[model samples]
Target chain A: MDAESTAASKGALVDLDEATCWSLLGPAGIGRLSWTSGGKPFVVPVNYRVSDGRLEVVTAAYSAIARECDDAFVALEADSTDAEHHAGWSVLVQGTAAIDFQHPSSDGPRPWPAGVRRQLLVITPASVTGRRLT
Target chain B: MDAESTAASKGALVDLDEATCWSLLGPAGIGRLSWTSGGKPFVVPVNYRVSDGRLEVVTAAYSAIARECDDAFVALEADSTDAEHHAGWSVLVQGTAAIDFQHPSSDGPRPWPAGVRRQLLVITPASVTGRRLT
Candidate 1:
């Protein structure tokens, strides 16, 4: 509590605007996906790619993500941290998930695992927010 | 698709049992916390510690995690991966979070950001699951 109290008086929270948030998403290909199934929440890491204001990803047709994320509201996050240095930045994208079955995944990030990840999904964000801890 | 098919026929998925799940959690103090806020899912990482089958953490009183995680069902995950080798493992804890105001967060994992993280919380897990991609 001593450290916390002293630190609280000089909070270093920085707000990241929309453009900055998108920029942070630019060089990142892996992120965590949060989604709900039957009213309970779950989170898992996925290989992702973002461009033109949209987040794109693919998963195995029978994987848990493919089964749970169709038409669901989800949040995807990517971050960089240096714990020993006490510095980090995080970006969160909250949106409605839409599965694209027609075109299929052409040229985008692939699944990390050894499998046929045929499920192509896209997220149209309702809001994008980010923050930096300096 | 060619790479996927080859990998699929030789799937490298490995199941991680309860004991292994806890072992992977050892010495790791940071992880992502997933919780639902107003019927939508969200995730943020936090500093966390595990002991005696319980996961303990603290957060700023006014932070989003403190407000949404009390008495709520949440999922916490920690993982390590090597992209070049496609090797990774993840552990997930699903449970009900309880806020302990009387205890007042004494000698536990504290928040990383410089703030008064007074919300002392404990998660009693209902299930612990894990997986390894070799």
Candidate 2:
């Protein structure tokens, strides 16, 4: 579509549907995940790939973030806004997290990329919801 | 203005200026605050008010969030999205936090509402930035 036509077609507010949210999270490679560990609040930006409708990321072992985040309540979020698209949207997924603690060499998926030493943290969302701007 | 004119006037994307972000955070009263403690992550939904370019909220003394967050890095976030306006925005303020640690008898601001105890946790944002969707 041309720029003018796209601008004309854009809406001012958008209440995103569940399908749209799923699509956005599935294809996006980045988002912030918030959780509670050791009774304190924490947020980390991760390069993540969504799988099974959940957020997945890798972390180093024995680190502060890993140490605190065993069995936690996690929230994931994504949004966008720009000049040509005076609109944006955000989705939040709140869920429980667990470590794929099994060693990577045997049965389960290869959990880490280069420079990733700790176990994998998978956020299995209990409630996934989102909102959009028109 | 009529609906059509307003619609036409709306931009597709908006690169929000600092003034706009300040305005949005200032008037709004709700956001999520994240922090780390004892090697774990934690997050709490708060009813906050911005004061002196920082985010302020109340908490009880001896709380888990209070004990772990001493001299910690905290993040505060706010965003909005809708259908009539297909746009949204997100602002992140990262900073150090501290408790007022004082009783609310004679000197400082009365820190809590009804059902609020403990001291105050004020997030003095070291870096404040935001993005908008057009």
The prediction achieving the highest lDDT against the true structure is 1
Q: Compared with the true structure, what per-residue lDDT tens digits does model 2 show for residues B1-134?
A: 55456446553444566777788787545566677544433454455777767677766566655775557778777765443544566676777888777635232322222223446777888777766656
Write candidate 1's Cα lDDT for A1-134 as tens digits: 37647686544868899999898889547788889876677877788888567898888788888788889899998887778766788888999987778745556676777766677788899989998888
Docking class of 2: incorrect
Model 2 spans with C-alpha error above 4 angstroms = A1-32, A35-122, A125-134, B1-15, B38-40, B83-85, B103-116
lDDT of model 1, residue A89:
83
* Candidate 1 local lDDT, residue A52: 64
lDDT of 2 at A93: 67
Compute DockQ for each candidate against the true complex.
0.56, 0.09
Instruction: Give lDDT for model 1.
Output: 0.81
| Candidate 1 C-alpha lDDT tens digits along B1-134 | 37656676543868799999999999556788889988788877788888679898888788887789999999998888777876788888889997778765556785767766687778999989988988
Worst 10 residues of 1 chain B by lDDT: B2-11
Candidates in order have lDDT scores of 0.81, 0.60
Candidate 1: Cα lDDT at B104: 53
